[model samples]
Target: MVKLFNSRSSRPFRIILLVIAAIAAVAACAHADTPPAIVIAPSPFAWSVVVALVVVIIALLGVFLGMVNKSLGKSVQIKATVKKTVEDSYARKIRNEYQAKQALLDKKIEQVRQRFTMVMIKVKNLLDTLDHKELFNAISNLIEVDIGASRYVIFLVDPVKHELYPFRWQGYSDSAVEKFSMSVENAHALTYALKRKQTIYRDAATSDIELRKLLDREPLSNMLVAIPLFGKEKNFGVVHIAAFADGHTEIDESEIRFLSTLPTFIGGALANADIFVQTREELTSAKQVTEHEIAEKRRLQEIFSRYTSAELIESLLRNPEKIDLGGVNKTAAIMFTDIVGFTAFSSRMNPKEVVILMNEYLSRMTEVILDYQGEIDKFIGDAIMARFGVLSDLPYPAKNAVEAACAMMEELELLSSDWANRGLQGFNIRVGIATGEVLAGNIGSSRRQEFTVMGTTVNLASRLETLNKELGTRILVDEATFVQLPRGVKHQKRENVRIRGLDTPVTIYEILEQVKSAKIVSIQPKLDQLASRNNQSTDKDALPDTPPVAGIKRPDN
Candidate 1:
């Protein structure tokens, strides 16, 4: 029991021991004065009473200890419950804090995402447009409509002038905008931004006193931002944004960061716009030059047609590059026609009369030559030097030459009659035709050039014209040309003559007139052998009489 009490209830066990020891001493003292048996016999009743009292006292102590144990257990249980409730309250508080932080974090993340997306769309719009004005308008819309800036202006640099020019703006009048424009000498935020090649602002942390002072001079917003546009080469321009629409006093760091990227996009866009404008202008200028060249070529064609055949003019125009100003040898038929005695006739008549007669005669002759697709090589005083197959290939050059020569003679007859009726001295011309290889191209120095044929064939044709005076014929042709004529050509064969510049004598023929049936009535003229005389002596003293027999008057040689 002592071990149990010592182990279970140490303080209560000590109190019980002290009381039990005192009781034992009192019992010993009372029993010492009397005999043991006699004392026991007399105290049976008293013993019962004493036993009951002791039992009552022990029971009361047991009840008190039980109450103490129960009370102590209840106190321990209450402490445990309070501790659990406090822990639960702390856990609830921590959970609430965690949830509130998560909600706040989610809201921040969503706001960042939304802001990022909005900025991306604004940048995309700026990149998509290439026109200078359109790009400015897109920037304006992003600032005033997207970014919510109440007032804004876009400026672009003039590369040549090295000055800033207003590109676009919103919420500013013309006078206000002009006052706000910045240059190297200006005291504005744009100038400072450009100088630093960074952004300038008049806001919470950063303040631009110069810009504020500049704005104070005018009726403009105070809160402003100026970001310089940097290009590959240099700063292209600047953007000025001021006065938030919602009346925000300061710009957010996120907004400033987003606005900083605009210069890169806008600079590249402006460069591309410049390239497009330059390319379009170059194309327009090239188109105009091409049109002008075509017009000039047409004018040249018209002018060339007046000197050569229409077909030759068209051919020249089509292939102007192929036209060799350098000479080329070509097979051609050359015709040389001259007035029979133009020098002597002009001496006899006045200058006006000579001009009138020559104009009329040459006009008729030129018409016939052009109609037959002949190129007039040149005019030698009162003579015409023309070619049939020089610049272009002629299918029937020999035939064209013969026909043109005959037409000229016929027209000359009518002209002679007209001259006679006008009391002017009548005129006659002789024609010489030949066919052979000749050099045909532009000939002369750089200053003056003439497109003509040059060879033995040309000299032979000239000699043949002189031979007409000795032969008493109007039209004479070398044997080379006579044989190429069509079978139905009308011609009278003349004597074989030794033409200058030829090794051997060539047979010649005189074309009279084509018959009504297009058949030739040609006869080798019966003539006595005559001395080869120079044409200069044929009309040295006087001119021929009126019209001779076959529309040509020939003096006796």
Candidate 2:
């Protein structure tokens, strides 16, 4: 048996014999060891108990073996189940973490997209309006409502005036807003932004004392942003925004980035507004200047009308440069006419009556002078000094003067008759005429000047006027004047008289009337005819000696 146990050939048969021997040996031992007492022919209950014990013991043994086998199998199954559960739980945990991360990333992306979209919309809205007030209101609305900034202010820089004034504001009262306005030179933050041409932020650490103080004074956030309104040439101004209105402050990076691009639009709007204001001002100034010039001209016309005839005034106005404050030497006829006994006549009447009479006589004489296109130099007491051909070149100045003198004497008759009807004294006037070179133009101080003749010609005219009283004549002409008279105009020769201030005796003439057949009643007709004839003769080069036509008389002198 030992050999079989050790050998591999009879292993199966030897294992079966060994099992049978061990069982027989156990049965022999059970047979040899007997109990001390035994029950024979036991009762049914006792016998049943014994059998039940056997069954119980067998069942107990079977249960023990089955329990061992089940323990091994359960251990293996529990291990496998535990491993599968652990692997599923770990994988599920990793999946949940990935899902949570993806969800969070999607949420952040949506927020960023929404923020960008909002900023783009706001930027588009900002450019829609061009009105200054509207633009300011729109900008304020975007910052305060859309951009979520609580407080904001817009400052426009006036480069010409060198000032920065608050243009618009939000979240502040009128008085408070007024306080924020300051000069650009004094606003340190604004100045820095403008100088750098960039955006700047002001906080506790910023090195701007005035800005810090200003922030402290207003109901603004501690964190403030200043964005320069950049222009093509320079910065227009600044837009100041505050982070907090009245609560905790938070600054969004996107908001700042968005706002940094808005000043280009604002700058363009401001430039247009400024140009409009300047252009309007210039137009207003130009209108004022034009009105002033018109008023000045009207005033000048009124003043000049009082000194000369309307015709002379028109001529002077046409050539205003000729109305200078100096003298020009020219050949002209100066006539001096006065009441023959004016001193005696005035003494006999009251001052009022004398003025009336003098004005009456002077008015009639002035009418005759103006009718002949002569300038009344001045009215001296009851005497008149007039010049012919000073303002306009007369065809014949001496002839015009002679004709004016004759007309004056003729008109006096009607004037005296009217004065007689009014019971005013009637007087005769002595006239003197001289033709020579005289300084004729405005002459006097800057404050006041008179357009009158000054020279020996004027003096001689005065001397000749006095000779009328001695000669018992109403009209007298010096030799220089008499030679210019047309033969058709009737004049009588007077004796040679040495007038005062005259170095030599002057031949004087007494102008009477015009020859009736000649139809030369006044020098005006003769002058017109003369001008016509000269103009025709000049162009045709055919000078006619007989005054060009039969209707006109020739100057036989």
Candidate 3:
């Protein structure tokens, strides 16, 4: 058992014992306790009491939290029920509104389809023909009506000058009136559209100040739509639709696709029409020129046929310009044909009969010359001077001249039959063919040019025909003509003689029967025979009162 003691009772016993041990304890304590001793702290009962109070407060708080949790759960349940009900009600209302709006939008779409169909019908009316101004007026009117535009302008090209010109202008604002000229080159907007072969639209042209100035105040197109009439490698013009619609009236893809496509067809039609019109005008002018040329050619043919044969006339007609002042040296068989009794025949005949006879003989001989491809140079009275192998193209001129002479002789056979039919005997014709170099060209003064052969060769051919009367043959061909002639031609030895103008005496041959003849004499004796007959014919006319029944003595032969 333990008892509590007071401090006084405990101190005396401690002090009595401390006498012996106190001194020892005091010395050890003093040595150990040099820096001052601190007393150890004791645990407080007040702290435990404070801890108990905090625990009590925490327990109260837990109880209050439990009650608040139960009340808040009830409140939250009520609010959630109300919120869900409100959300479901709002969802139904909004859904109904959306369905009604969708139906209205569908109705609007159907109406737009109907109007677009009508617009298409009207567009077909414009495509009926490829007329520009008419189509543009219709299109601009459509824009002004549909889009509520104030003004419209159309520009087209002047076909004559190919310059851009204005077609029509509608509703002008007075502030900017008078200036409407828009050159295609100067119009960057229009040129760009045309070059691309597409449709271009500007919602606001007035916004571009520089462009507005060029437009010259006459209601600048707030919204300008252009379609290019572009064809296959051809540009006809631009179809411009100008309108004073608000800037918000922008052309969308659908409008561009519709407008630009028709322009392609329109452009092609315009191109076809333009080409046709131009071609028609050209053909008319060409016909006029050709008719005039033909008339001139026919007139020339009539006049020159007397001098040149028909074959030669055709060549001259084809290239009238070939007759130039130039000469060529060619070896030719020059032929001269003269009537043996021309002087006596002329003296016996009247002027009228002489002309008629001369024309008849000339026409017949000219045909013969051409049949042999001989070009007749000219006719000196009843005498004919023709040249064979006088050409630039014929390389074998010497050979050709012989062939022509052979053909000319053959043609003379036809005349015998013609004379029998005409009740008159054919006259003896003297033909002379000489081969030599001669100058053939259009020779004359600058005022006039005559295509004639010149030189001693021509003179020799003329003089040779006169020699035919002495040679005792129908045709006299020089040694030159005989050497060039092919063996196929029928020729016999005529005579040998010294040509008057030449130093050498050349041997000549005669083509007696071009077809088949026994032998025709040179017929120089026929010249005298014809002269005697001509005297009888002249004496009858000169004898004024010769009785019809009286036998007029035949003229002495």
Candidate 4:
């Protein structure tokens, strides 16, 4: 019975017991209520029996109530326990899910970190490699390892050929690789990637028939990934990776993303390498050109020094731009000197002796001309044509010409004395100077060019030089040169004479000598002044009309 009360069926059982107790109490009340034949006054015991019956009923009710309350409490406790168990189960399930997701997230993070590290290392290697071959090798290794590619080929665009040629590759035979070339003009995956400047993912199984046919000869498993290598300005090439025919090797989204990013570094490295190579080649070429120029300058100096003054040669070398092949019209002092009686002198002497004497005479005269900063235009047999203020503008070209002429006369006298001492015939030289405008520049054919002056001034100087023999004078000058002569120079006006190539008579002057005590003014300051003024205008008329020569004072009248 106790077990029955404790069981789930106990509620109905207790209710049946309560209903039976009520019926028994009602029967006892009915009996008591009935008029008993033997009783006049209600017996105390009867009342007490009724009271006891009532008390028993109340006690049973109380016990049943208490049992009901206890059942309710037990039911509440059971519900609480069941709810706690459900909450614990749910928490466990939730914890497991959280842990799973967290683990997966951590794995992804680690993968990203690893990819980053690998990319950094590969980029460093690419940067360190300067040579093209080494750079290609590094790129191949980077792709194969970092991208988890089974086979890969790096193709560089041949801009001229309009094609893509493999620069580096793996998992392909040399012959196959060499034979494999794709025209960028063709419509294909590689070209598409290059044209779009993006990564292209192609599945051989689903790819177009044309693409599949193109890949049939290659050692590709099934999948192809074409990543365009971008440079700073243009596309360098494409990196083609073959993979995924086998189930074990697959390219995930992460690897695809990595591959996409890798081309930037690769392209930059390639561009930098190309620039380095070009710069090196350019520097080498420039060095060769500079060396050649130096050597040519040396050769030119050696040859030119044999004719012109050292100072003139140095100036020309310093400012090579001054020696333009195109002629320029400028006012210059032209001087000509000739050995008197040279034809007769050579006729009497043997060929070797004639050469030796002529060389000695020319050498002495050349020394005097160069001492005055003159350019020996050319040596015509026994005659020398020299110029002052032709290569460079001089403030005192006329004075320099006159001084040079006088110095040559003195030098010839010394040579004559030397030749007399040596038991050789003494020689005489006549000089002529004229100041006027002339065309000065290199003049000749392409094969052989000579720097000389041409114009009326040159003709007049030559004619005056020949006139010296007729006038019985050693040095003769035109009026233009005489007016510019220094005050201390000994000169006299001559009768006007007509010369070859001139329709009018030309006034001449004989330059006897220059004052030995006169001091030579440095030409550097005047050259600087002239240079500054010439910068404003290069026209011939811009020059001073009658600039006096330096190193000597000009005559007042």
TM-score of each: 0.40, 0.42, 0.37, 0.42
Model 3 CA deviation exceeding 4 Å by range: 1-324, 348-350, 395-413, 446-448, 494-496, 514-557
Worst 10 residues of 1 by lDDT: 523-532
Task: Give per-residue CA lDDT, model 2, range 20-71, as digits (tens).
Answer: 5665564455346673354445456654465456556555665665577678
Using alpha carbons, what is the TM-score of model 3?
0.37
lDDT of 2 at 70: 71
Off by over 4 Å in 1: 1-303, 513-557
Q: lDDT by residue for model 1 over 353-420, one digit each (tens)?
A: 88998888887889889878888888888889999877777754655787788878777778889888
lDDT leader: 4
For model 4, state the Cα shift of residue 87 in Å: 99
With candidate 4 superimposed using the best TM-score fit, by how many Å does residue 487's alpha carbon deviate from the native?
1.5
| Model 3 C-alpha lDDT per residue in residues 1-557, reported as the tens digit of each score | 12423443244334434453544454455447472475435546554464456545555665566567668778999999999999999999999999998787667556556656766676667667444345555666655664345665545554334444444556665334336544556645655566667666664445766444443322234436766766786666665555545634566544544455556665655554342222212322333334455455555454455555444555556555544437766667788878888788678767876676667777777776665567778888788888876643343343455455545555555665775687645566787777677887768888976777898768877877888788666677665555444333466664447878887665666655452311222332443354444545533422221112112222221
User: Which model is ahead, 1 or 4, in terms of TM-score?
Assistant: 4
Reference-based TM-score, model 4: 0.42
Q: Which whole-number lDDT from 0 to 100 does residue 143 have in model 1?
A: 66
lDDT of each: 0.66, 0.64, 0.58, 0.70
In candidate 2, which residue ranges exceed 4 Å CA deviation? Answer: 1-303, 513-519, 522-557
Query: Candidate 4 lDDT, tens digit per residue, 1-557?
Result: 67868887456556756776776776566567574455445556665576667667766786887788789889999999999999999999999999998898778768977987888887887787555556666776677666667677777776545677776677778888867687888656677678878776664324566555444343323436788888877688887777532434445555555666776887888776552222222322333334445455565565476777645665666566676657888788999988889888888878988788788888888887887888788889889999998887676687788777777777777888987888888778888888888998778898988778899888989999999888898788887776555444566776658787888776678776553313323443554554455456533422233343332323333
The best candidate by TM-score is 4
Instruction: Give candidate 4's error at residue 227 in angstroms.
Output: 64
